[model samples]
Target: MHAIRIEEHGGPEVMRWTELPDPVPGPGEALVRLGAAGVNYLDVGARAQGTGGWAAPAVLGAEGMGHVTALGPGVHGLAVGDRVAWFYHPGSYAELLAVPADSLVKVPDGVPDELAGGVLMQGLTANHLGTETYPVGPGDTAVVHAAAGGVGLLLTQLVKARGGNVIGLVSRPEKTDAARAAGADHVLVHSGAGFEEAVRELTGGRGADVVYDGGGADTFTSSQLALRPHGVHAYYGPFMGVPTLRPTDLPNSILLTYPVVHHHVATREALVRRSGEVFDLLLDGRLTLRVTGRYRLAEAARAHADLESRRTTGKLMLLP
Candidate 1:
């Protein structure tokens, strides 16, 4: 078997594709033959600085889909040759993985391999933002930062599906079409702050019901200012920069929360249910997944570099 192993955290150049002894399923685990693995900024963080609790001297990646080749002792509800996907499991950069069966969900029919392989991590994050952090309803307004990016694109569709309006934010003009294509009601091309006024104007001065912030400190204030009084501000990813705030620093009586996807799907039943909702939306044609890049598993270093450059949009998948 071959996997991307990083001896020390540094940069994309540190990732190396190397052969290793094949993994075997352990107790309560399933041995999966790798079909596709999702490439995420999380992997880059793990490689570059050992962020996200993934220490060095380890294989990279946490999300993917594959076929079950074998099951370990005491495992049930799964069989050999079943197609499965997991939202969180370390060492997913390899060609085969012995993942806990409880962490696995059966991929439903009509879900493409690419979507099934990569959707859960970012998809569940979007799901948590739209459902738990703030349940978007009809006539509600949401300001989503990085609306053309992976989580933003999906969150746009989710807000639309829930009958809410989306004001999408993009860093570049070239990204406007992508954000609009994902069902954003309006797209704004800007940097840092200064877009709150536009958001207020779009909402007729009442301001947005919520702001889904994926970027870090630079846009933090603007995201908060764009929301109405008592509106929710859900911040998820902070790979860019972490912001600081005092309780008195908060404006508009707005609520600020840093939502983690694990809390949204804390149990196996919740995982099955939440993932089913995402898959059903995809099957019903209401939610569309954009896979903008695909790479060979051995070429993972190049994928990391591309993601780090922040040029690629939507999802990137690695096929073994």
Candidate 2:
């Protein structure tokens, strides 16, 4: 089998498509033949800095869907040939992955392989923002930064589905339509800050009920400014840049939260349940998975490059 491997952390150039032995399922593990792997900024962070569990000399991916080719002892409720998807298992960039069966959810009939493969990481994050972080409700307004990006698009659709209005913030003018197409009630073209005033104007001076901020530091203050007093600021876009602030730096009575996807799915039961919620929306057509770029597994470096350039919108997938 072949997988993208990195011996050192640096640029996308560090990722190498190298040949390796095929993986075999161990106890409670399912051998998954990689159908597709979602390329996230998380993977880029891992490749560049060996972030978290992704140390060097490792395969580089976290979320994906695949077919069950084999099952190990004690792996029940799953069988060979079952199509399964996982939200996070690490080492998912390979042609085959031996993932713990409990870590996966069965992909239902209506969801396509590519969509199943790509949606969970970002989908679940969006779910966390809308359902838990702020609990969006009817007539509430939300500010979604990078509204054409993967998480942004999903978050926009979810906020709208939950009866909240979305004011999408996109980096370029070309992305405005994509945000609107995803059900953004209003779309603003922004390069850095300054979208707050428009959000306030749209909300008639009350500001948004919550701001799903993925713009990182450059737009942090503005994200706060866009929110209503006591409104939630869910900052999940640390990859763009991380900003620090004193407690006194907070404006208004706005609540600031860094909602981690893990906290939302901290247990096996929670993982299955939250994943079901996202998948149900996909099946019902309330949520859409847009694959803006698809690359052969070997071309992952180029995919990373495209993602980092911020020119690619929606999802990018790697097929093995």
Candidate 3:
């Protein structure tokens, strides 16, 4: 089998396509012949920083969709030939992956492989963020940073479905249309800062009820300024480096949260329930997955470069 491996921490160029011995499933695992693998910031950042819970010479991917070709001893509830998608699994950038059976989620019949693979991690994160973390609902005004990015796009759609008004924040004008298409009621490009004033102006001085900030330091202060009294700020990612907060930095009665999808869907039951909900929404056409870029598995470096460049919208996947 062949996989994209990171032999040393560096830039996107550090990712190498290499041949490897085929892997066999261990007990309670299944060997899946991958159709597509989701390329995410986590994968790219991990490859660059050497800090994604693995070391050098590691196969670096966290999610994929595929068909089960073999099962190891003690595996149950999933069998050979099952079409499945999983998150938090390593080595998904390969032609075949050995994933724990319990980690697998059945992909619905109509969901394409790329879509399934594309949404597993980001969609699940959006699910918890939209429905559970801050609970965006009727009459609420929500602000999402990086609104045209993978998780942001899904989060925008889900927020709209829940009856919340969405304000999407992006770094460039090219991303605004995609964010609007994803259901953002307002899309703001961060030109010369002071985006908080725009949010206030759009909301008629009321500010947003919730801010889903994935951009970290670059947007944290402005996101803080853009919140209403008692509003919640859910900081989920560090795309611009981590930000710091002080007690005096926020409004009175404000709530600050940082929800990670893995922690939210930590168990089989949680994973199944959340993923099922996302699939239900996707199948019903209430939610959509957009794969703006596709790369051959051998072009993993270019995929990472495109992602880091912030020029691509929605999801990027690798077909093996």
Candidate 4:
């Protein structure tokens, strides 16, 4: 099997592709012959700083879509030849991955491997954010930073589908257009002065009912400022960098929530039930899986470079 391994963390240049022994599934696990692997901001963060939780020489990737090539002992619900998509903490960026049986979800008919790969992590993040964290309603308004990025695009659509209005903040004009196409009611370019004030004006002075701030350090303060009193502010990622804040930094009246999807959807039942709803939306054509870029497995370094430099939009996938 071929895999990209990080012996040390620093930059995309550190990623090395090499032939490796195939991974064998353990009890309650399955070996997936990966078709496509999703590239996420977390992978970039891991490559740059190392996953603070893991050691060196780690395989980095969170989600992928593939087929069950082998099922280990005690893995019953899934079988060899079944099309599946899975989320793994550290080993999806390979030709073969040993994923816990519990993490595997059967891919629906007609959903391509690329699309499935694109959505698993980002789609599940959007589902938990929209349905669990803030639970946006018809008249509610949300301000989503990086609205043209993978999770942002999906989150915007899910919020709109629930009848909420979305105020999308993007770093570029083209991304602004993409955000609007994804169902944001208004798109605001973040470079302009008074960007936070613009969000207040868009919400008719009360501010957004919820603010999804994945931009981390750069937009953290503005995100809190853009939320209404008592409104929730959810911070998930640190695409800019991990946020450092003082106790007084947040608005006194607002509720701050840092909900990690990994913890929120910990159980197999929870993960599947939540992901099933997302898949239903995708299948019904209500949700669009926007795959903005694709690269071969050996080009994993280039993929990371594009994501880190913000040179790509929506979801990026690595085909194996």
Ordered from best to worst TM-score, the candidate numbers read: 1, 2, 3, 4
Model 3: per-residue lDDT, tens digit, 166-278? 99998899999999999999999983347999999999998899989888677777787899989898988764578767888677578888888888798999999989999
lDDT of 4 at 187: 91
Error of 4 at 282 (Å): 0.2
- TM-score for every candidate vs. truth? 0.99, 0.98, 0.97, 0.96
Candidate structures ordered by lDDT, highest first: 2, 1, 3, 4
Q: How much does candidate 4 score in TM-score?
A: 0.96
lDDT value for model 1:
0.92
Highest lDDT scorer: 2
Which stretches in model 1 have alpha-carbon errors above 4 Å? Answer: none
Cα-lDDT of candidate 2: 0.93
| All-Cα superposition RMSD per candidate | 0.8, 0.9, 1.2, 1.5
Q: How close is candidate 2 to the true structure, as a TM-score?
A: 0.98
| Candidate 4 per-residue C-alpha lDDT over 212-263 given as tens digits, one digit per residue, 9 for 90 to 100 | 8888767777888888888898988655666777777778488888878887
Which residue pairs show collisions in model 1?
none
Residue-level lDDT for 192 in candidate 1? 79
Candidate 2 at residue 56, lDDT?
A: 87
Residue-level lDDT of model 1, residues 31-110, one tens digit each, is: 99989999988888888888888788999999999999999999999999999999889999999999999999999988
Give the Cα lDDT of each candidate. 0.92, 0.93, 0.88, 0.85
